[model samples]
Target chain A: MKRVGIKDVAREAGVSPTTVSLVLNGQSARIPDTTRDRVRRVATEIGYAPNSVARSLRTQRTHTIALISDRIATTPFAVEMVQAAQDVAREHGYLLLLVNTDGDHDVEREAVDALLSRQVDGMVYACMWSQVVDVPAGLPAGTVFLDGRPAGGGFPAVMPDDRAGAMAAVQELVDQGHTRIAYIDAGEEPVPIASRLRHEGYLEVLRRAGIEPDPSLRVEASITTAAGGVAAAGELLDRPPAQRPTAIFCFNDRVAMGAYRAARHRGLEIPTDLSVVGYDDQQFIAAELDPPLTTVALPHYEMGRWAMQVRLGVLAAPTENDGVHLMPCPLIRRESVAPPPAQHPAPAGDGE
Target chain B: MKRVGIKDVAREAGVSPTTVSLVLNGQSARIPDTTRDRVRRVATEIGYAPNSVARSLRTQRTHTIALISDRIATTPFAVEMVQAAQDVAREHGYLLLLVNTDGDHDVEREAVDALLSRQVDGMVYACMWSQVVDVPAGLPAGTVFLDGRPAGGGFPAVMPDDRAGAMAAVQELVDQGHTRIAYIDAGEEPVPIASRLRHEGYLEVLRRAGIEPDPSLRVEASITTAAGGVAAAGELLDRPPAQRPTAIFCFNDRVAMGAYRAARHRGLEIPTDLSVVGYDDQQFIAAELDPPLTTVALPHYEMGRWAMQVRLGVLAAPTENDGVHLMPCPLIRRESVAPPPAQHPAPAGDGE
Candidate 1:
């Protein structure tokens, strides 16, 4: 029993192999519907099945994209980048391949080799945490960076607007009529590159508001955890009531939680006692916390969608403007912000 | 200019195409070292760059696996499943393709068709939340389900051991001398299928301990959120002090947080007033919850790695395993659970 070939179908349908190929591949718009129907019926009657491998070789298009990342699956919320990119790729009739390199350069090289060997049309390089990354060798056209900027400056990058986000968060606090705002930062290393951008934004907004910079108000967290927030907040609040800032801007949501804990420890109620704002609206932390949290939203999903679009655009026609593309980080207002108290008071309520 | 082909290199090196191919592909074990070195030198002199697509065609292996998931990116914490699987796939020299269908049957169908057409070697079908799923049509050889069970038999699956986890949690509570233990459950929808299994485990443990189950001690909350924990806990503690259960097991960590809030609202301290245990370690939630939560680790990462291994195994040689593969769910001991209080007292302390 021999597999029926396309030529056999063409002969049976009284048409050329190209006509049969067009009809079978679903690219038969130019061909007549009646002829296509006849060709399809003939192919079905002859049991003709197109070979996938042969088709790929002939078409030179796999309709696939590789998503190279440093451990997206392990990161809790950052999976949104992959999810959104996959959705966009599916819409464009492309499959999104995920390669988690585990921060091992060798594994990443193997992944790129495998994907390239399979002839993926494009790729989107993403990072679990936003940072500056070294561009991989053999990066073809249509490759875009998501959440990480390329250090070499050839690849286009799509990232969170961290500076603008911090500025907006501080501006929101100021709009609520609070002036004395302190900045809690993750000390160094391991902290995302966007953290520095956010710190810059915090200072820029503070200067614009004419609040003189106070080095005493800025506390660096050694471990970059909620414990850091607690210690930093404690440092600021332990000072004389008159000298203390009315509000605090945390680098991220986890630090904000620490600040919340610190405020509670000092018998200060959120908003009513200390207006608090956080970044990266991590849903579990922000919504689940008591009184909820007002924070900055990282546009992870949208950035993914935009990155895919940019990749597709590069595939269509190469463009210049290798500059960074910054997506907005919107402010998510909850119940955590309020005007500063007239005077810090002694505990009116007992332990909560 | 004509591309430098393997045949050209072979001609220049005075060797057959097979000898040249073996040397260039790093498979020169059978050939002499001198011959290998000569072929390599000639290939390099000619600037021979192997065409990846042609190599794939000759090899007949894509070294790719597809992960068909139901909204993994949207669901928080479940990304660990992807991360672990991706790492495993990378270890095996396979690129993992992600297809997030968002529960759309059409998109899922398209994903299957596209992956099949692109000749992916295997697939790992996963769900963001654990549940029973219908096997997709036209599932080829070398496929496994992750964090979900195929409704029909004849497929391998890897999932968290929910029953054993619950039993272990209950056993831990019993070991600490708490008899009047209660169970709080999420009402109906969105309550993971594992919840029912956990409930069964709880009952099994209680029966083993010679403790008769109390129906009134079981309170089903409306939503699966922290608010649900609060309401259910409030219902349990609203009764007379003599009749109240000493220990309560909330369905999940979020609910446990609610229970924490409820205990605080009632001026009851965790462990001293109420011993709380949660499920799904949910690092962000469980670890950050002030006293932290003593909960069950869902084994999401392990489950993912196991699923990928199963997929690779299937690709190697398919095996039949109709039964569910229940991975261990370890207990993470935190400060949340403690021995039942000696006596239930009325509100005494103002706060902490």
Candidate 2:
């Protein structure tokens, strides 16, 4: 079948092609609403589709974005962020071309080169985990970061407020009348710095409760994996029964999963014996756990929207700003965390 | 710095621009090997990148593939299939544009229209599960199906060999001497025909071993989720002792996880107490379990490669073939299954 054109819609609607184009483009402010409606109805009847490639060539705008990531396309839950970005881009008549770099600098360079060749109008960089890394030098004019910021500086980054998320989680435990909460950090070589931010949040909350943060109560996780969470809990569990912290805050959900394993290994029941709180609120891990996981959730979908907006703005106006936008990390309450044991006094802590 | 162009590469290499172009495009067969190497080296050294968009317009080939997925991008391990496709596409100088439809016909139509407008050369439609779904009508001619087949066939499709995978798993159980093996199917409302295929493989293997498949031992999982798995195992475990099957073959990994939970709830240890086998080989669920899991792994990475090859093949030569290719699903032996109890006799039945 011959492809339908705007001319067909115009001829059928008894209108000029210019009027048909204006109506189809939603730029029918001068045209009467009735005319616009009729033109649209006729276009649908005739299957009129504006030749997008032809339009792109004329306008010098591909309306396509390149989302280059280490593994966002493969990582669990992280892909949701990409999907959210796709949804936003689609709303704005743009499609996303994702290039998985696999953390190889050479692969990243090739991916960028390939996307540039395809004429992607803008670019977004995503990392599975929030981390501080050097922005690729000489990026296209319109580039944005997701879940990370340039260790050095370049574009606007939308990262989860890990400090706020950790504070909210610890505060949840505090509200349940538990004062002695343990902080499980992402160890010494914390890549993202969220581990330190979250640790600081925990300390600040303890100080707010008028309990001096105990150095001994603070422990570092080996890595952000489940094994790390398990090891971090092992140290705290080693302490005498009454002396151990009543509750623990993990750096991420995987760490919390590790804590669950450690607790189960040591015959410790969750919530009943120990109140646990985690971050990242990874649905697959959080929802599938035994009692479910009460954790802090990052606004990945919103973050995606914000990143797309940043790229869109940069494309519209070539402006540069060294901005770090920390999106809110909301607290998701489930069954994992609860009040510490009844016999333990309110604000239980070491005899300082 | 100003962008380097073909003219610059020719000048830098002391060769004609035609020679540089030919070398860059791999049309350097007529050129001397040493001259070709020098031109390529000069191109890389001077950072000469061909104007891809202009070239695409000239060649009428975008060298871009659209990966339209229902939920593969949002799924856990299934996203790896996309990554595999991306890796293969990248090697062949193609970038992938991923659009998630979530099984909505409207969204699928929009995604296809948008991609067609962007001049994507081909498309691969992927679904998280292997099911027979209605192929969206009027899809671009260069399209292939992944993990699913068109209800009414036209294009090429690649699906997991679930029957072969199931037979292999059951045979492993049988080799270790299991006759009364239970089949926890995906139920009669199975969206993916793989469930039934796997169940059939199990029965066929049992019959081959001269064992009549027990009707009571066969149960169907309500859903493929972990909860569905747990429920399916619950019904099987409800039977009186000595009547229960010596081993169980779950529909998928999540179902196997459920069987693990049910076994634990009933004080039965995996392999030692009741040998359990699962399908899908989901890393998170399979690896993290107490004893790990022995399961059949769908060759998702291979399936992706197959889908990409099909699309590329169609683009190379517009040939028509109503083909459904079933890729191998290899067995990944972990710790979930083992020899049946020594006390049990050969061909152990309900009479035991």
Candidate 3:
């Protein structure tokens, strides 16, 4: 099929090509609405796509943005950030050029170079997980970081409020009247910044509740997976009946799942014999567990939108100290939390 | 900092702007290696980036490929297709323009129009799961379909071999000496094409093995979630001991997880009392299941790479009937499959 152009739409509408262009581009203030509607209808009928390449050269702005990510494309739920960024870019008449560099420096450099060559108006540097990363050299000004912070922070960064999220998770258990709560920590060495912050929040909540934080109540998982949760929860549940924790707070939903398995293996019922709380309300795992998990949701979608807004100059970068935007993490309550069993003593006329 | 230009590199390298452009563009065959090396080194040192916008205006080729996906960005594992396509496009000196429409037709139309205006060299219409869809009108030739086939069937398509993958999953069970197999099907009416194909594969394998397919053993889940699997698998497992299925094949990993819970509720041990298999070897769920699941992997990465190759003309589109490229789905063996318990004779000193 012949490629439709402004000339084709003009010929079909019986108007000059310049008139067609003006009407279609919304630059025809002097033209009647009837003529503008006719030109647009004719253009749509004939599929007359505007040549952005030619327009880009004349205007010197391609109306394109580059979203360079460190493996966000391959992860679950986190990709919502990419989707939000894309939606914002599209709303502003810009297309997104996406590049996933798999955290390889060489690939990132090449991707940056390619995006620069394409003359994208701005860029968003996103990470799969919240962390402190070294921003690559040669990134043009106006690059916004999402779910991460620059190591020597000056650029605008949007990340989840890990400490607040942790506090919320622990507070949920506290609200349920559980005093002896055990924590399964994601304890890889050089503990991740999130792990540290969440740990601090857990400690704060316990202290604020007037509960003495027991040293034996805290157990570290080798990793942050469900398997890790199982191993760590096993340790806490292995204690004598009097010392066993009534509730367990996990690092993330994956560990929470492991904890579920551990409880089941020991014939403990959730929200009955034991209560559990988790973090990172990851899709599928959080709401889909046997008894849906109560977790803290990372505001990935909000962070994504915020990052794009900063990059597009729709939202100004925070000028405060550290220049990081902390998006709130809300606690999602489900069926996994309840009062301690001791609070629900059996009636006097029961089995005995 | 002011953007460095070709002239800056030319001046520093002691060469004309045209010579520098030629060297950077890799059209410097006649130029001496020493001159080429100097020009490249100076370009790198001064950070002279090539202007693709102007070059595209002159060449009429934008060197950009648009990947339009239907909710792929939000799903797990399937985004690997996007990554694979990006890698291939990058290797060929092109950038990927990604747009996810979340299966909204209006959004899809707008996205298609925007990409068409941007003058992308090619496009890839990707679906999150394998199915037949109507190709949107006005897309240029050379557009490739990934993980889906065009309803009218005239375009190049790359999709997983669902039927073959199903056969493989069942064959693994047969190899383990299972005959009393049940299927936990994704039972929504007008079943998804993948479910239909996989179900056919299961029936074909049973018939080929001389085992009559039992209608009661083929239970359907209302949805393809882990919860659905539990409901459907519960019905199949609720039978008397003599009538119980020796194994179950789940529609997907989510359902398999449900089956796991169902079996556990019935005091059945996986691979000891019953064996199970699942499809879509989703990350975190499949491999991370307590006893790692044995499942089939949808060749998303391969289909992605293949689609890109077809888009880039690196590989020729199939000339045969249908023009759909069937990428093989590989069965990933874990600990989920085992010989039927009946196949093992009781030892002399057994519990009985």
Candidate 4:
């Protein structure tokens, strides 16, 4: 069978090939509605598949955006961001091309060159975790960053408001009438921006509540995983009844899971005996805990949507001085928080 | 400055535009190496970016493939498959375009039409979970399925060997001196192929060991999540000490997590009082458990690579008669498995 081309559609529709092209390429606003309909109907009747590749060469608009990320598609973290970007892009008749670099610079360069070779209209550079990243060279002029900011601070970035999220988490604990609060900070030297901002939020809340931050109550987890949570929370939980914190704020949901285990090991019932709050509201881990978990949501989906909008010009592009968009991180209330216990129990045997 | 084109490179290299196009498009095999290197050097020196869209229109080879998946890119499950497919495609000098349909049929049709319009050389149709899916209409011929088989059974498919994976999980328990074992199956009504195959593996292993399959031991989880596992495993663990199984083979990692909690509530330490094995070594949930879970890994990454290889003709395409490729699922040994206890303790208070 012979493939139908634009010339065939033009001959059948009794119009110039350029006219047929304009009607099919969605640039037919000036063309009468009847002519547009006739061209489309004839093309459909003759089985003519409009070739975007050919149209793109003439118009310099492929209507395709490339999303290059370090590990968003492969890792379990922040997958919603990709979905949200795809959703917005689809609505605008633009296809999204995904490329995961696996955190390799060479792979990233290759991916950028490939997208540029195809003349993608725009690019979305995303990161799995919220951090400052060095924007690779050769990216197009209007590249938008998701969940991260450029180290040189020129590109537009959409990131979760970590400090505000932390304040919300701690405020919930304070609202529950808990004064003795402990914080399990994550990461070591050169801590991530999220960790630093979250810690600052925690202290700000304590200060506003007229409560002095206790040195012993502030502990650092070796990492942000559940294992780290257990060790950090265990130290605070092992303290005498009078000295132990009544509530704990963890770095992330994984660490909160550790707090759950630590509390379980010490025979402490959540909320009743101790209250806990976590950050990043990670899927499965947060909602699947025994008492469920009260935590801060990272706004990944919203960030994705915002970045796509910026890239596509649906939203105004951020200026050079105001390029970073700090999306709000809302508090998700679950069953993990309540008023402090009436009285504390005596110290129990230390359990690993 | 004006944009550089093939004409500029041709003029600079003292060659015709045809020669410039042939060399830059990787079709310089018939040309002398000296001319080919000279053309490429001139093209690079002048910063002439090859317009692939224009080249594709003339040659009908876009060097691009589309991966249209039902939730694979958005969801955490089977994400490695996308990564693997991208890696293989990138190695072959092909860019992979990703479109997630979000399980909507209309959305899928639009995605397919969009890809076809763009003239992708081929497509990989992927599903987040292994199952028989109805191939959406309008997908071009030679489309390959990953982690799923077409319901009509014509397209080539790459899927995990769920039956063999279950066998490995159960065989491990049998080798570890566990006589009495229980299974927590998932999903109801239209049970997924994985559930049925895994059950068969369990029964087959038990029969070969000459152990009678206990009807009470084979229970069903209302859902595959941790909450469902708690309810299902709680029922089994609530049985009399003499009647309880020493090991529990959960449907997946989430269910295994529930079994852990159920055992803790019953004062049964993992592996010491009860042994547990899970399937789908899901990221975070499997490795981040209290004692890392022993589970079977779904061959998602391998399946992705295989499907891409078939699509790109790197491997022999599956014939209609042998279109389904079953990749093996290997057992990841962790701390969750051990020998059964020496003696059963007397029935203690029933714990939820």
Most DockQ-accurate candidate: 3
lDDT of 2 by residue, A1-352 (tens): 7667778888999999999988888898899989989999998888777766666655667888999888754456777778788888877878889888887888887788777766679999997778977666456855788888777665678888888888899999999988778888877653557777888788888888888778888888878777778888988987897668888888878888888878877878898888898888876677767768999987888888888877877333223446778889999999998888876455767588
Task: Chain A TM-score per model, please list them.
Answer: 0.89, 0.82, 0.88, 0.92
Q: lDDT by residue for model 3 over B1-352, one digit each (tens)?
A: 6678889999999999999989988899899999999999988898777788888978879999999998854576888888899989989988999998887888888888888888889999999888888778666777899988888888999888889999999999988988889998888744388898899999999999999998888889998888899999999889986677999999999999999989989988998888999999998899888688999998888899999999999999997868998889999999999999964464657675
Name every residue pair that clashes in candidate 2. none
Q: Which digits, one per residue and each the tens of the lDDT, describe model 4 over residues A1-352?
A: 8678999999999999999989987999899999999999999999888788988998899999999999854457577888889889999999988898988999999889889989999999999888888888798787999988888887888989999999999999999989999999986834488888998999999999999989788899898788999999999999888789999999989889999989998899997889999998888789999899999998888999999999999998777556998899999999999999878443666676
lDDT of 3 by residue, A168-211 (tens): 88898899888998888888744387888898999999999999
Instruction: Show where candidate 1 strays beyond 4 Å.
Output: A1-16, A25-33, A42-52, A314-322, A344-352, B1-4, B22-33, B44-52, B55-59, B314-321, B344-352
Share of reference contacts found in each model: 0.69, 0.52, 0.73, 0.73
Candidate 1 i-RMS (Å)?
A: 2.3
Instruction: Report how far off residue A317 is in candidate 4 (Å).
Output: 2.5
Candidate 3 chain A, run of 10 with poorest lDDT: A343-352
- C-alpha displacement of B238 in model 2, angstroms? 3.1
Per-residue C-alpha lDDT of model 1 across residues A1-352, encoded as one tens digit per residue: 5546789999999999999988987998899889999998988787666656667676777777888887765466787878788878877777787887776777777667667766778888998788888777667755788898788777778889899999999999888878888989888846568778988998899899898878788887765568778888889899997679899998888888899889988889998999999989987778877879999999999988888888877333224456678889999999999988878455777779
The residue pairs that clash in candidate 4, if any, are none
Model with the higher DockQ, candidate 2 or 4: 4
The C-alpha TM-scores of every prediction are: 0.91, 0.85, 0.92, 0.93
Tens digit per residue, CA lDDT, model 1, B269-330: 88888898999988678888878889999998888888888788733323444656889999
Give candidate 4 regions above 4 Å deviation.
A13-15, A22-38, A189-191, A344-352, B22-39, B189-191, B344-352
